[model samples]
Target chain A: MATRTQAAPTTWPHLGLGARRALWAYAFLLVPLAFFLAIRLAPAASSLYISLHEWNIISPEKPFVGLRNFQTLLADPRFARAALNTVRYVAVGIPAQIVLGLLLAMALRRVTRLRGLFRALYFMPFVTPVVAAAWVWQWMYSEQFGPLNSILVALGLPTLQFLRSPGQALYAITAMIVWQYLGFQIVIFLAGLEAIPRVYYEAAEVDGASGWQLFRHVTIPLLNPTLVFSIVYSTIIYLQLFTQVLNMTFQDQGGPLASTLTLVLYVYQLGFQRFRMGEAAAATAVLFAVILAITLLQMKILSKPVEY
Target chain B: MKHVLALLAAVGLLLGLASVGATQQQVTITYWQYFFESKVRLIDQLIPQFQAQNPGIRVVHENFPYDTYNQKVASAVPAGQGPDVINLFYGWVPLYVDSGYLQPLPTDAFPVQELEREFVPMLRNSRFDGKYWALPTAVRSLAMFYNDDLLARAGVARAPVTWDEFLVAAEKTTVRDAAGRIQVEGFGIAPGGQDHHLIREVLFRQWGAAPYSPDGRRVTYATPQGAEALRWYTDLITRHKVGAIDFFPGANGYRNAFMAGRAAMIFDGSFAIGAIRGGTRAKWGVAPLPRRSAGGEASNFGSYWVHGLTVRATGPKRDAAIRFLKFLVSPEVQRVWLERVGELPASRSLVSDARLANDAVFGPFIQGLAYSRATFFVDETAQRQVLMDAVNEVVVNNKSPMQALQEAAAKEQKILDDFWTKRAKKQ
Candidate 1:
């Protein structure tokens, strides 16, 4: 009873060399894993929980009202408008951005002189601060004193009401957003264009394919991955659009009859402005579902295999 | 001689220990406010004075950018870790109260009778649920700010007195290029800006109907009078063409236009006087807003920023916050604020002082107090957005005034109903 043997100098056993190395690797990853769990996943799960409860941040009580927030959302006309507007942004904005990006990429690929300078010039807007770009667009879109109107007037054409009219405000903001992101999409498409083997084009020419046919049959199919990525990326960005609309329409935040209201903007308004955290959480949950569904669908439709 | 030196050292050590004890007993309270340059400077000066008056207490003043201040408060106060005292916009009071973020002033320390006697009538805005929740050092009322150079260039002799005269003056001042593009707008119509207040409170009140019901429980702007008021307001842009919908683009539109001498006339609050005086080289004059008719009832919109004690503040910290608030509204501090910040003192006695009442720039705002009404709102920004939308629908979307007002009323009523319903549930 009482024979205390000093434990044989303790060392890691039962771990094979491969297992031990893997453990060290896992140990190295643990920090980021813990960080992600704490920062991103925890808040995401809590938001889902908050969506089911009535919360006002400072209130002592947070009563659970299961599904009530979502039910209210369905009945909310503003939510409907916001959802429709978001759809409109993606439907119109994404394609325009992609097509414009592809065209610019194709044109730039043929030019060898000062190609890098041209590329940098196009990419400048992508790197510029969004707030600064938004303000510049706001000034350019001003109905009365804007440079665009000035040009139209100088040309003896009637000036178009840009951001001022509800009918045109959404399109004006969408155009700004498209322009701001076009450079990024173009760079991606250009990289994709450069990656396509020149042998395919030469082969198409040897087969008596015209320029239009070669582009349609060879380039378009091969560029599917880039097209898919840009479409998915732009869709997510357009769905979560905030800064441009906020800065351009600074007067009302989201106004001109809520014409420019997007899903994320509505979430911000509900959470920060109205302090309806429960409704905001529910709206965010809906936004998450929409983003997930659209991403999956885009992957399914656009990510089909392209054979050589 | 050695013993005498030891005795002196002992006494010096005792004094040092006693001073440390005194310093330990002192309490420091933090105060938060939105950034306003002159106001912050005045507050900075007053902090030392306050510390001197109450030696056992020290105040730490912090400020945030205006737009994010409310969000910062909402998140911080709930975590029991915000400033002991806060200065918030009067419009935000109801929302803060609903969230239970603010503590009602202790009657023993701040009696209602004293507040009523000391502050102007607009102090009524600070009272809710049978308790006074906050106090204000200064108040503001809307008035017309005209660029004198622009007006004189157009040959308008003086500020217009009636709506008809205002229309004519605006028309005369308007300068359009040969292409029919506006070079200088005669008047600014910023539906999402200050014009929102003009249409919602002043014009609605001038039209012989309140924007909301007397109890402030329902929207009342869907009526014929409301539509008529809105129609007339929109006519300035749609029919008279003196002002356009986007006359002044971006935020702070009308005020910026007036400051830049692009717009001849603008409706703004007394708080803007300092900015106008400092930022603009153009000569500007403050005048009372024109009435519906020459002899009709005069109405103006009033708003103020109120300093509140957070519910999280307790014990000696709470007591210190109260003491600081008392010192803040003291007549001496109020006078300092007025001189530095260009704000009308909230204290009735100070407001009526002959020195302020007779000043040409301050006179109109002071005179407007008699007929001014502070709008009661659950969410002032959201409600203003509704009215702004109505104006936009008419001016931009070409919706009829009646239809737009009707839609706005329904939306506003829903907001009011939601506020009351939630409040009822909480109670």
Candidate 2:
């Protein structure tokens, strides 16, 4: 036993061929690397270059105007409104979605039979296509015959102009977004909850710790990893929000007064609608930076080093 | 080794035969269009006619809702999977043209000049940037649609002819609850939706202010006449209490409001005539838009352009596409499309036919086309968005018309200035 403990493990000296084979395996990855560079990196780099010039995509001539597009965007009132709306969406919408998701996950965890079925039902909205989901929501939010307002009227309550009101339009759009993404967060939280060792809960119970105390001490600390994930993921998604506001609104005005216009929508409108591709690229660059910072900040605030 | 080689040779021969068979098959032309189910069925019936007219070419149709059609085209075209032929709105022509996605019609194939004589001046509305990007499938104009029963109830004998009379009629016809909130409005004008027509374009004509300058270089809406026209529309809701700030908000259609007796009168286009029939059982009458300030040489026509077919600049099938376009524009096809979908025929000769001229609906429709003026197709996106924003600010937000127009003009001028300044460097 003493000799076994003292003896050094034999190191393979003749495995040079295997190491060389591994190097060859790494080189084989060049195909996928090239694909990633073409699809993601190349387009990103091109967008930055194009952003410096005034290009209308199809125009025979492109006039290179340095920093002019950025200056024009700074002067645009629409851009300011869109930025404010985006900030508001990420601030309010993300937190609400995460909290609702966590609560849903806790409730679902208690179901013993057909738990998978219940999980599927809750995940359905997240899995549904964005276009179809948005259309259904539009119908539900319809001012005249939508089931939502109709029910309100039936209850002898005033029918709210959900999308048509300047004050309510942004909040209404946020609610739809939250509803769609909350299920995703819940699934993540549920997986995290399931992974927690049950022995700790049993030990706390035997120690005479109440439900609230156990949750405060054991559950909250253990769920930090999942909470961080939810925060970072939701932040990135909410920052890049676009399609929801585009399809639902009317008058191409971003409605009731540019209330629902967000950053990505603004970028899209600049590039596609206004043909200011340079400014659109600049806006997209800014959006990427903002998302990156938010995700980093979230990680810094929520992440905890696991102790062995 | 010999047996494996024999099997491989057999497989190669079979694959060659299959490839040859595929190449020899009929060319399926994908046609993406925006039409309702009824029009789709009618087109399906007409497809056999087209197929007979052109041998070996089979047309496959894919349809989408009008709202999503352009978006679908935009995403699909870039992927090289777009339809061979597409129906596009006239307003969107500038965008398609600028993107270099569209092909100009060959002069030899369609004979634009020969077809021009067959069309009315209003049908020439499809011209943009000195090029005919689209051909008007049919034409329509904004007209006063009124509920006869509601007008009768309100003791108004006839439709209002002038602005002052219209206000009086609206005031008379309007009903309110005990709370003094509007219940049954006399005229349904949604500042958000139809304000451009109900207020701006109509009043611009009445004030004798050209929507664009004579040179088509700048917006002249900041002139005194344009300001007056703008104020007149704004004052209707603020002072006259005749219009609604949120008019029929949500999913309520303005035309449906009139048909359902929710409002006695509404301003709408001929495209809305079909939808109105399904909204209510009320007897309705169509009339001209109320004039600006009683009998001041009434100008009462507003128009929107329909899509035209064009051949691509660089496509192997340009000739075939133009042939299809010509066949589609024939008088017989025009009549069938117009009759089925309420699309007013662009052909001048077709409009005056006894069948179209005598039909109660088409009587006003054709008459209005004569008085109609097409909206300017501004190539500048900044100016267009600013103009739209100004309209919303003036009409819906109840902003000062002068201030709004001034701001719009200044913004538009800056864009123009930027364009020229940049162009100088390029030269």
Candidate 3:
């Protein structure tokens, strides 16, 4: 029968099912692969090429300037300030968001009553438009007319200049960003919390483990993956912050002496506002490198091997 | 069946021919402007009238939010597609011209001598590199907007006529609560908005030093006169305590504060008139900006938007755009723009029109136009940011005025130098 089958039709080459399956999977992936190559990779590569030239958006000619754009960026004090502000945003914003998110997640995990309602309420800001949230925050941060200052005045406390004060503008914007992203982090943390087997907790409880000890030895290690993901995710978000700063300081984008300028905002100001596309591309390239380095560093330090 | 099929084919051919004929006759040209309610309404009205006059040409008017307008134009133009006609801020003309995004009006169609005679002297700003790049249907100049009710409450008789009087009036009009918090601001220090214009044009000119060199290649604001301008402006917030940098944080802060009766006076352009009329119940008056002294050099900020054809426009589209522009700048249309949009007419002939000159609110703005000067900006927005930063450094960060002005001047000069250097290399 085997000889007859072999002799009957040998139209196809003998290949493993796995090989055939991979070929079919790649065939299916071709559309998305081509899409990424066209939209994402092409622009990224062109941005690198554009960084080495002096080309205004409307200019027909793009003169090659070598590393002059980068040199100009290095000399620009505004760029330096923007870089520092971006670092401050990630340094201050990420931890505050992660801690608050984790604390909220921990509290909600124990609450059986109104838990879904609470979860939805916490997740609301994540879904809210960033521009609307920024406008609301801008009103709240107003020194004279805002509700926060009104309350402060009502309580006979000195009103703080929130967005107006250069010293305070960055922090105020960071607070709003954290508040907006808190809901998202909380949802992620809850997912991680739920995935922890209840048997482990019950087993620990039977062994008379205290809450602190149980959290330290059992829950913490298991939640490592979630923690790593949140840190890297929040880090990237804060690193490239644009909308909040843009909306809050709409008149003079990234202002009150540019205390709130982020790397991305600087790039935007350069490319669109200043009509310096080459310098803007250089700034973007710097941002890309920064994000790559930080993400790799995060994976190296935070991600641990998980064993069942 | 063959006859029926033949008839059907004949009808299809005729319909296709008709469509092609119709399309060939209609030349649609897009016109874009930054969103302003009054301007939008004016354009909405004008488009129908324009189309009625020119049946073969169809005008498509589009408005974008002001913040994104420049970026939209820049992106759209480079792709060899954008509005055939565009309304650009006067300060942005230089940048657009340098980038070759704008096409100068043909000399025969828009002769320089005719433009000089018809339009305000400030229209010379549109003439760059010996060409008329754009034309304004209407122009705006800074004027003092006062809340009459607040002025009465403060016991001030009228808007201040001099900077010294302005200060005293501001101090008297200012109200403070028991805890020393400002209950009402006397004046809105719009550092983030028009304060740059105020310092550069009004104050600097009054101090007898032009803000920039005649060639527009160097910033002259580092001079003693410019230093004094910066000092006086910051002192309103710091020493006088009548105004604060945060009084109105956003773009329309001064206008909003004045309209809300929170501020007794504000230095804003004629553009604020419509918003003031619509927004506030407070009695208001418009006056020319107060001078450094009662008889000091009279100067006001001449900032306006001009309509021009983009470089991408060609053939029938170019002809259509120019025709539309001529229609827009026609006396009748200019009058419509002035009456509806609250901006002064750009036409020199209309400036002497009794109806506009006799109007109480527009009179001051029109009178101020004679002394107005439009700044030559490489990148007006960026240059303004430098000025605003200097203001912030002084008022918000407590930096010395001289120090801030010096730094700003250096930065601004660098921008000018860079622009000129690039231009030279391109040449």
Candidate 4:
């Protein structure tokens, strides 16, 4: 039978018309691939190239100074502070948003009355304009006239400089970010929660499991994918903290002592304010690398197949 | 087979037709500005007037809110999408100049020397690099606007001419409740704010110094005069207790408090003249800012000048733009700018015209313009940010005046070094 097959000539090599059809199918994908290359990849690649040069955007002449812009950025104390602030924002904000999101989701799952209305109310901030929300936070944090100060004074508590204190500004900004974005994660968690089968909880109840026992044994294990989703999404968003801090801080002081200055704001200020486009581009590349690494790690750690 | 041939024929026709429709049309010149309510009216009014003046050319006017104008302009200029003429402040000149985004206004082209000769010297702060980069359309300066009814009630006859007399008036004007809580402050100056520009300018001149060196090249505020200016401002809140941060609740809260008659005296710029008059029910009068010390010189503070137009070097419609620019700066538009918008006209001739001089609110604003000085530093950003930062440190953080000034000077020096080093290397 093997000899007969060999003599008949491999059917795969004889399939010319099928191979030609496959080539046409591959050619169709080239449109989207070309678009991705043109819009996204081209700019990123150009930014990487430009980062190695010393360029004033309007100058008639440009000369390459390999990695000098990066060197300058590294040497600058402000950049280091900005990096630390960004790390702190991500480290503190991501976990808080996820946990809070999950808890709210669970609570919402159990509620039967006005669930739709409550869901919409909770999700409002997620859909609100970040700039407008930031401005609202600024009003709330207003030292003298804000509602927060009024409440504090009424309670006989010392009025805190929420955005004015360098020490407190970063955390205050992070809290605002978390407050604004938590609703989004909550909605995501809700969708994940809805996907879980009711039979698992029933089975746990039949097994004579307590409330905590059921959650610990069955819920936790089953919600692994949801937890992974929240983690990965929140990590990406938290690392790019900018809008709230930029709007809240006075133009002169990026932070009280440059505390709330994030990587994205720094890139914008350097490129636009300082006219250091090359340095800004390099910082952007670094930001991209950071996001890529975290995303890869998430996939590796959370991609295990589950046994139901 | 017939359907396939027809489809191919239609596709071929569409492709063939698409190749023929590519040609550049009439050039559209973009004008970017930050327009107030009144300014918007004038801008709208001028479009037809401008079009009538230059028939062939089309001007696309873009307006933005006052707050984000600077950032928007800065970002747009480098991308080749910036307006042919941008309404900008004098402080933005250095940044645009450094980046080579601005085309210099030659003396011969715009007759800047003639405009300079006609415009007030104080308003000439917009000119830079020994050439005009911007035309001053409207000038703003610090002036003392008081509630006449409140002043009369407080038993003060007129605006104080000297610092000591001002304090005395403030003391007489302020009122407190039974609990010793301040019910009415003598003056409403927002404390805990960075850079009280109007107040600082008056003090700097009183001490016989300016914010920066005359050349806009170094830190001149570190001198004794600048330190004296710093102290005088600090004393207004800490010592005199006339104006306090605690009194002004938040940003612009002091101004609102003043309007509400909680404060007897308020020092601000011309921009507030219209708002103060309209926003409040109280009878008000305007006066020049109080002098520093008896016989000591005083400077007008808080000159917030707007940007005028400049024709781009490579622009095709240079002649059309120049004619349009001239008309925009003419006395007719200046009158519209003054009467309609309440902006102080940049032209000396139009300002001296009887119409503006007769207005009660603008009279002092115009008078104060003669003494006005632009805040200048080697790095424009340093001049703006460092000063504001220092004020915040002193007023909000309660740092000593000398310490704040010293810290600001150090920051300014570092910025100056960065700017000069780059320039030197280029040379």
Best by DockQ: 1
Residues forming the 10-long window of minimal summed lDDT in candidate 2 chain B: B305-314
Residue-by-residue lDDT tens digits, candidate 2, A1-308 = 56533442334334454675686787998889999999999999988787778776435445678888778778878888988898888889988998888888999999889999988988888998886787678767765546887777778778776776667888888999998998788899999998889998999999999989988888878988988888888887877788788766644446656788888988877777666678898788778778888888889878976552
Better of 1 and 2 by TM-score: 1
What's the TM-score of chain A alone for every prediction? 0.94, 0.89, 0.94, 0.89
User: Which model scores highest in TM-score?
Assistant: 1
lDDT of every predicted structure (CA atoms)? 0.86, 0.71, 0.86, 0.72
Q: Say which prediction, candidate 3 or candidate 4, comes out ahead on DockQ.
A: 3
TM-score order of candidates, top first: 1, 3, 4, 2
Candidate 1 Cα errors over 4 Å, as ranges: A1-17, B1-28, B60-62, B65-68, B74-79, B313-319
Residues B57-165 of candidate 3 have per-residue lDDT tens digits of 9999999998888767767766766898999888777777877788888888998889898888777755677788999988998888888888888889988999999
Clashing pairs in model 4? B88-B307
**Which structure is stronger by lDDT: 2 or 4?**
4
Q: Which is better, 2 or 3, measured by TM-score? A: 3
**Model 3, residue A127: displacement in angstroms?**
2.9
Chain A of candidate 4 gets a TM-score of 0.89
DockQ (C-alpha) of model 4? 0.10
Candidate 1, residue A156: how far the Cα is off, in Å: 3.2
